[model samples]
Target: MVRTLRTSRASRALRTSCAARPEYDSAPTGGRKSARRRTGTAVGTVLALIAASAAWVVGAAPSADALPNGLALTPPMGWNSWNKFGCNITEQKVESVADYLVSSGLAASGYAYVDIDDCWMAGSRDAAGRLVPDPVKFPDGISGTAAYVHAKGLKLGIYESAGTKTCAGYPGSLGHEQTDANSFASWGVDLLKYDNCNDDGTSAQRRDTTMRDALANNSSGRAILFSLCEWGVDNVWTWGAGVGNMWRTTGDINDSYGSLLSIFHANVKLAQYAGPGGWNDPDMLEVGNGGMSFTEDRSEFSLWAEMAAPLITGNDLPNSSAATASILGNRDVVAVDQDALGKQGVQVSAAGGLDVLAKPLAGGDVSVALFNENSGAATISTTASAVGLPASSSGYSLDNLWSHVKTTTSGAISATVPGHGTVLFRVSTGSATSTGTTHALVGASSGRCLDAYDNETTPGTKIEIWDCNGGANQKVTLTAAGELRLYGGTQCLDATGAATTAGTKVELWNCNGGTNQQWRPNADGTVTGVQSGLCLDVTGGDQPAGNVNGTQLELWNCNGGANQQWRLS
Candidate 1:
């Protein structure tokens, strides 16, 4: 059973906590894969694992190599079977997807696993009581299906429940964990989605444990990629170690930006638990599902990739449009997920609903995810300097992992992303020189960068983006502009600038430019508005109009609130 990450056929899959729950139901598109963690001893019975090394603490994140599984599955990248199009799955759909993955060269690019989520099985079990394939649906049966997939140079995957019925109300693994695991192995199933649905808090652990034990025991000769699908209840981080290849660490993900932000912020602290044989899953990504803006999807993909979460595609493959595939096909971003060392990124800063995350890879290159979780446009800004990098980080090589563009960093860096979008970058740890044409920001023409909002009204108001001509609205500098200027001039972008701090207002009166507008970019990836000095609040508005002169702004602590995001372009 010892092997590399099922993804690479070269390394391994990889591990976290949190109590955030979600409203559970189904609009019929399918269901959300689900989170939490538990404890484990750092010590291990190495005799059993010839292909791996040191054991990981259930809840405690082990240093790089200390993870039970090798760094094989970091940044696991593949297409899911939900989202853009839900469970309207078909055999031909998977085949076509396999075709697309191979013909399109995506499989070689790391989209190796073609997974069939729940419902691929029939409504009835075989006479033996094991779940059966919907022969009418999967005419070739899973084994044939798997053979077909493997023929296309891809691996095959399928889903099951640890309950009496799958999330779709068909057969499950509940009382038949061992039976199902063995059956899956028999069917040539390489990956298993052992879920915890139909099980509440008490039964959740029981379901996960029983299913994991079954999968491990049955996966004797061949390696099986195990994905534990319990919504992070009872702190799965402490209990998930060595339980599966990757386990869900949060509630089901929705098509909304807030949903993604909530999960992403929650995963930062649990970053240490991820590595090789196990990982902390943030549920499946909702990219290309139209549940969120392209920006939000980018944010979703980027952060998850940076966090080394699984790349389980949750939409119907054939039905997935090119845009959806494009999201899944990003190689640079995928590289962060498929990084050799496999480390999940941690949030360095968040405010105005913008998140700054960074993951260290095998080489000196570092993967950074700049996520805009807001419902509207935001100019998310942060510099390598803001993330505790040495001041020498100023001119590091900045490559846009998403756009696939290479540039250089400046004293700081700023990226503008639309609602829900993200900008991912790989920063090389080396000296950089501004070629004027090569820097991502700044030059002889960039002048200065700033965001102006008269956030003196209620929170969640329209946050306006503007050019920093040093006018009254944009004349603020990074220092005490003189004195307190609590919410004045242009609109309220509150003076204090704490990302997670809540409750401040923006007002526009004059531009005496006090500490309210004299804020500095904190090393934690947060921005200080300087005027009124409060962190800029998004006020909960989903999409703000650009250059709106009377935009009302509120202030709050800087926990990456969407309103607090600003770029100096």
Candidate 2:
């Protein structure tokens, strides 16, 4: 979506009297708030301040007040108009797209909503102060369009701004929230994408919460899916769960590989903030938009599904290429996105422009994505145990979502992915289990062993690397549950803080079967943590002299350095 304000005669006329100034229509880059001046009338300003203060106090922690509208239990899959058609949308275009969604089998695969983005409304409100549909663009009006889409067993979504004027300079619903909401519900709108433009400097939480309440208490009592487009400012993901069904976690995404990669890096880290009723939106999909290659487009779809992001397509459906149709229509990939488990995938391994993501499913299955962000083909690999599966000696099944090829691996899952390409797989572990083999883990570089500091045997004792003297403290067992057990299985190697990031300290903790304590001894002689997907390093792995005795072990990116390599002996 274009970020700058679009000034039409109608928008210009309306802006002349409002105290609020024009800003970028899209979210500010780098998660920074816009610098545009904000102003409102005396009463409006005072009330906004009060609401901001109240939200700041009550929203100090993540809000649990997610709308109980019972929609978007899984990220809503649909087609939006902003990315492709932009302000060129029309009733015929929307209706045609709805027909294509059904005829092309997209709706059967879960692409249900046909949403109209910005510029769908008239330049000004009607005489009764309610928003009006653009006469020329939506000739049948929103209600008529909704009826047509509903007749096809699909839903209709509409857009509005939470400011005095929309980014496109049309009248917004800032102060006219309830009135606009009543209009939307009465018109059969099933969803609302609320943008942030020409805002009055009130806290984003306050503005979004106001609209959330208005939609909830609207006179029609319709259950409208709330989508917040604040562009990630004010840390929307922190408390967005209670405010909207989904909240944008980054700026608008263009049809480019760089934009997709950048947004992926930003949104993937916020997996903890997304779940059943709420989700972290990385903006709509730009697949089939032609800015990126077919490989890149597929990568975008795979990564979004891997992240459990809302699969709202922003491309023209009728004229899309077969490659686009195949990518978007892959039921296996879509299943991962619509998995009943509702868990967002976490990046288990990322190094040298190669990344591996793993998401657990509801029925003992796991979906993994091996993404190569480099400019050339690269072989990316991860073990079954590394992706939260038990090290099954009987092997695990890997179903390639894109290729429709099935393969089995004893433990290793590897693929040579092209540049900007993704290898998506659904891994299923049968009855295989980890072996209870006990051995001293000898560091490949230091020739030292994994040890509990000072033989403390405490829950939080530091796990370090020391001389391999066959001591009891150095003996570790690989348990069936994917844990490294010490002291006769009493203590397990744990990534402190349950952290998934690198440099997390390894500690001795009681085996509670938490993912943080899961360890996988890979065939490459590297001991990796299932939770962090990081290697058990001897600290300072890149040092020239290698690690010293008593150097505490921490989780670090798997760089194949000697310090990160371990041998079970």
Candidate 3:
């Protein structure tokens, strides 16, 4: 069954205990009706009390419009309790997991956060209206557990809903956001997995932003990573970077190969939304879970790393097998996920149940994954040039991340991947030419070359589309500094005013190596500006018949149209 349809054991117990309370009747229901049913005068009274508290001083609160807390510089690598222990979590179990994370070498390998996922709280709030840890389940309280985790040099994460009740029927932080944020900050929580269950009809953005502001304004002066668990509704990725460190792009993941593959497909396309402080979370890792085969588990880990998804393992680490440990502790594979460049892998090609993905790493290395999704083994192949490595006569070095075998490839990056398996390689382009490679930037739709208007060498000359006549003005060189140089390396293609908005003009300027002049040639045959993230376009090229010689060039949204596509010929 899908994870969303499954209820935790603690939720059932909470339902039985709260049967007499009308407000608790809406624990399972979400949206508008549930909001009206659960939030009565008591919620408003509690908010009023919180607002009147000296802690709510207006000037101290961080701006709600501020950028996300700079916590997860890379996609978070950790373990969460929901997928395995669920609502059965206890202080001892959490402490034990922290122990295993350190002792099993996973911590040293990069897994850090030991996250508690729901049901650790009592059925009702205390008389003071503060959340209380269940005395039986968490004998030492959340603060004690966090202290234990912190002692082990790790961080602790806690889960709560944005509505009146959590998915597992625990009291959520919806209207009680500031109170709960203060409680979490006091407990020394390092991360907050804010779930979307049992939410009021309020817009997800507003509710999430409310809690984000609450967390920021907490008096403890702590920086907690905010993880939005809205399950991809409302295009969370589009605004998640400004609100949270990582955002879920799909529903909860189960321990099955089909679930893994579906989530991978759902998340791989969101590469542009992922970066240093924010990530596209495809739910937690099920590596040690029994539903998938060894090959499938390895494939899931490899793909998640390639896509730069948070490596939050959701399994019993203490009792995990040696193979599971090896897979989870593979330093080479983990390095790709934690690469400093923080570029998520993009699908280079996919067809016939075979796929190739490429991620650019810091220092000119690219991580390539050859995946076979069918029921049998197959050979998947792509060239170094196809994966965005600069062309070179000396060839590239391919380091098989999983096998730890090194080999040299003149250009081809092919692998015979088994069914439901992935062959991941780190392709080093150290031997590739670094000074520059001159080529004609030919527009795929217009069949014209990128040219300076009137062959002008003056700065601020408009770049335009013209017939490919092999002239010096049309010859562009991609350099090691990421600049698109023209006019015999004296002039560079630049986005006007370093603007990031669409329709920014492309102009020729002296080569001073500004970010506006930096261009990245994506595998999809589109060139994007480093500062703007906009594609080089032949004006009106979306309409096949509109583009002509002397048509102006501009930076526009990447619509995957033929007009935005280009060839470095």
Candidate 4:
């Protein structure tokens, strides 16, 4: 069976179960308040600021106010020790990160909660069956580390598996839910990352039980943020809201562009469960964490803002350089993380080499990020008047969040980006009009895809459609080789490319001097079909031949095959 999304509303039936250096009243979440929330059970409504002492079952479905308190975690920024240090995590490390949080000014910038990931525990529990910190690693013990973090003005977080063993094969919570929760709460723990790797894919009983037990242990009214790391079991998002403040919808992330992009694309639409406290976590940010580049790191950070994900950093804080610190210190982008609405943006459309991700911000403004995740350099032109804004966002005009630059984009927001790059913008509108189409398409120019300098690939290459880019597919560059080159990159049109005859396909093939891949557009709207000696044929001559998604194209006996024809409308 296809893997069903475990984050559906139904997944909240599992009951799983921080902080404040502030005189601040809780922030109202969601867009302009609709109605006052009547609190009773897990009321996740906008007005239900604090939760009462009613216990809940893990994944136990709750009312609209299901999110426990104001901790659904909009800006769950903290330091983690997995990606960089791996099993080298020690109490000293956690405590030092807490120190960095306070001293490096990260805590003041809204970065709190220092967490210890896998391997902080000894190989086995004690005779009393309680988890023990490795004497070598912690020296003092789990409680000592939590106390140290608290002294440093940061809350402490710990990790464990819901299964028989933690990811590192250390002692886990498994059947000892009550013991683990009691021990965690007793140790002054503030956050729990209950991973689900070693556990058998058995039933949801374990899920419900462990989560319930944790809630039972948090009787101190100290809201426990349960982070279910079940990797999309039973459409986890649906039931996840009832379980914890945040749950990871996907698996652990690597510090690579491909991995980051894949995870972001796979997870969207669950942003509704996110607010001030409840979050849809896309694992931890692998930014500035050694695995990916600066470009990849920027994109990863940008995506977290778009997804409204928990901004837990899994890198060594003490070792971060100036560049890394700057990437993490973008207060404006982080504001998107704290955008109160907590709505995760999604990939609305794709063309050329650009992609558009939109998240609704607090107040009336909407945050939109236009990212270039392609290889070569690229650009895509989009009219701001067409992007849900009225007159380029009121007083300050258009604001670019990532760069913190402000400009009047009353017409269009055209951006030039390096390959594997991005540009993020927050379009604020008090009374702006939503415009054009649901998703705007980028111009398909002529260029082999290209980097900053020139075409990265061989000239006269095939023309491929990347995320909406203006490189070459948008800009046609007729080549001297009698073949057309997408001005900047590789990818030529394939003439009668498919093996099949009738329901054959047409795509970007090689520019091997083939007729099937040649075409010329006239001064008028008509594009002369040079390849296959026929205009782009709309095989079977059907308009709106979609919904049955596998439709193919063939070079029809051209009676000016309408199906093969497209006029960039």
Candidate 5:
């Protein structure tokens, strides 16, 4: 009989927990209200003044607030010293990486944070029960090191475990949330990657939320990006949005091709669970680590970029090889990873050890990756229709993202991918249209069609942009009740809290014909919010594809741009 490996058993653990944040209240200021009243005279003027005041009051308070600092709008890109240096981390080493990130053009390419992973902490807590940097390894202490990193225009990230002792037997933040949070903030820590080792009986929410509240309510007023490194013990992806900006969804990845592919296969299924301010992390990247071939390394980076995963490098940045620098410094690949849409790629079709994945990009394009799992080269092919693109009489245009080459094909895209290698393409169709009675709403600016995030039919599931694959999540129908109903469900697209001003997030809820759910199409290719009379505009005003994603659908005054232009079907 075979025994289960510790890693395999740990991967199977799944549980649940709950936590809450304290409420905050603020009333409108007296001076602003008095100024509005002084200008009121006629009955129409009085009503307008009262309406403006009410709107102001409503806008002043958040309805269902989650994050306090509201940072990490996109998946973070940085360098993590774990897979390479591990417990051998030193302050001088971290400082050198910071310097190299700026000098070697990685920081300029959008890789910012320089994170010092585990073992940088002392063997024990201080007299006040607060964490202390290892004096021997970090001679300048965490504060001085943070100052040095800040001076280089790069943020600093520190690591800790949620239990009494970290994985390396160092003091953790189990029962000293307040003290540790304050200490980190005072030390100028910009981000925290909290692990879950040694957490014997602690609930996921109990352990993680304690730290989240401590950081959010810290006295220093420093906003730290919380990265949950729980190793997927509780299906963290299910409820991580309200807990942290990013959460690890797999076991630790070692510096090998097997480890990389294992983590990728595990985390790829969680695409819909990720969005702006929240991400599904497969753990830190192992790029440029000298374990995999250059081809495999390219495949790894390409897949991560297509998935919109964090681009954290875990290699020795200062002594990087020329080939490694080329892979990490490719601006085009980085663009796909940092796309403003923030949608993760999804597996569209798979068969015979060959898989085809598609990612809907911002500029009306789709990124395709043909991956082969075999040990030898294999031919893989998929048609445009199979990936949700309507057939075009003029055919499809293709761009090899890795090679930066452009070409056109009539029908199916076929390529011979090497063993464990990938062929990535950006595909677009010309003169495309749909004839169905009900149509999927596709953002002309984002190219991503409207989607019910996570494919969940629950009320309050946010409506977001995802790779459009002609699934039920992208289908919607207009009803006689003046409501746009989600296809195959009783829910309508409802604005969160019925908010009227710009930036009100849209979600799916029960169909009640509420004014907030009413939308009408205008002749100028704009969708008007019936209650607010504002155009439904894409957040970033259509700044071309591959710019930034996570720009939510908001209400703005009618402006004729591709962002506000919604192509039905």
Candidate 6:
């Protein structure tokens, strides 16, 4: 079949990424605009594409129940081409970097993925209407490049778009998902970074899901890690794990400190969405990009590592400075990123321009980040209890993640953090209360108890406040996984249907590890729904305490209200 030129209708959908390193597109202003890369001019970019492109057969792809082969159990570490070379990538360039990753000691450090972004393909498909690599750039094609990279003991990653044309205006995988997936798998590709560009009117979710299914269903034995690059549209973080190994949760990151910080600040709140087999990618790393000082670069690396992000280096490895090398090789820091527990950190407290972020690691240790975003150095303090240590612990043993020094604190740990810098700590504490021990969730306002309606154990039974009776129903256990369990751990205090509204019903449901079933007990005598960010509250505050019995419980704004406070006693 001969190739042909056709005019794509003007896409009402938005186009977005980086432009000449300028402020072409800023950090995410809204969900859609900030999530896209620079769109190539549609006309000249694709002079000719195969007129017989594969049909968009959604049914022929993999089953929704099927998953990509088991890989990226932890966030993947590696180097990428788009951030540094963009469309200037050549097979030799990738091969050279792959060699550097091995010789430079990055491979042993677990930085092994070498990915090529868009523009690797020729303008026209091959005789079979399959995508082809540029002969000039790779006389041997993608399979050759993959073999070269694999020979270096490193994995290979390829890029494509869910749209008709990629950001660079090359043919994408929209209708040819199965063909591209099979081609990539046949090439022995280990990763797929699928972007959303020139998508026309197709929804990001559907497009991304299509590619995910295709990759998962590929007949090749290779387990390709699917990275959905939708720029966090539709809050991809909440459901990205069902489709891909990792999903970009922010706009593209540049070399500047402002860009780094903007992306970081925007993404940190979505930490709960990340875990083993799934991660929130804050785009690629700019560690050796020369836009910011070594301090800022180190801070950037620390924050991303603390959040358990994929450590995909976007710097020129061969020309990296000593500082960049040091930042990348900090084994202790990388350990935090690759923790076995796979829990992403969260911002626990922020005051006076100082923010405290905490990630609970495996083995009862908590990673703490005292981040100073203010102009001058500030003394930041947070107690072990403040960071969600169990009530049984008196203090924690702290280790400096960067300096590798150990210390212990009986109460609060205070440090003077430089402006735009962070003091990272790994705090280990003793075991928490046993799972079977019952605790009364005493309300601050009414001084009453959080009681299940009529002591009912059935699902959907409403929750209400009652007098402190100390009965089996009034006594609930806080499981180590953050679930508040009633009925001897059989039923959980669930937010009805996972609702986040203030007046939504709170009920007893079968114990499941869903996010809505998890609750976070804070140092401020308040309990918040880990998934919804709403405080557990007693319905009416005006009623006198003695008469408050039987008052309905609801999720309300965290206003330090007596009604919204609870003590696990």
Query: Which has the greatest TM-score?
Result: 2
lDDT of 1 at 69: 37
The ten-residue window of minimal lDDT in model 2 covers 52-61
- Model 3 segments more than 4 A misplaced: 1-66, 430-569
How far residue 546's Cα lies from its native spot in candidate 2, in Å, is 57
TM for every model, in the order presented, reads 0.62, 0.66, 0.66, 0.63, 0.65, 0.65
Off by over 4 Å in 5: 1-68, 390-393, 430-569
**Candidate 2 Cα errors over 4 Å, as ranges:** 4-65, 431-569
Model 5's TM-score against the true structure: 0.65
> Candidate 4, 64: how far from true, in Å?
2.5
Q: What is the C-alpha lDDT of each candidate?
A: 0.55, 0.77, 0.76, 0.55, 0.69, 0.71
TM-score of 2: 0.66
Q: How many angstroms is residue 141 displaced in model 6 relative to the true structure, after the best TM-score fit?
A: 1.6
* Rank by lDDT (best first): 2, 3, 6, 5, 4, 1
Model 2 RMSD vs true structure: 21.3
Write model 2 residue lDDT over 112-140, tens digit each, in one string. Answer: 99998888888889899999999998889
Question: For residues 469-543, could you state the per-residue lDDT of candidate 1 as single tens digits?
Answer: 233444332223322222332333333333323455544434444455344433222355554445544344223
Runs with alpha carbons beyond 4 Å of true place in candidate 4: 1-65, 204-209, 219-221, 390-396, 429-569
lDDT per residue as tens, model 4, 402-520: 43334554466566655666677777643232121111111111101111122234433322222222333444444433343443325554554533244434555545666655655
- What 10-residue stretch in candidate 3 is worst by lDDT? 18-27
Q: After superposition, how far is residue 282 of candidate 2 from its true place, in Å?
A: 0.5
Specify the poorest-scoring 10-residue window by lDDT in model 5: 54-63
Maximum-lDDT candidate = 2
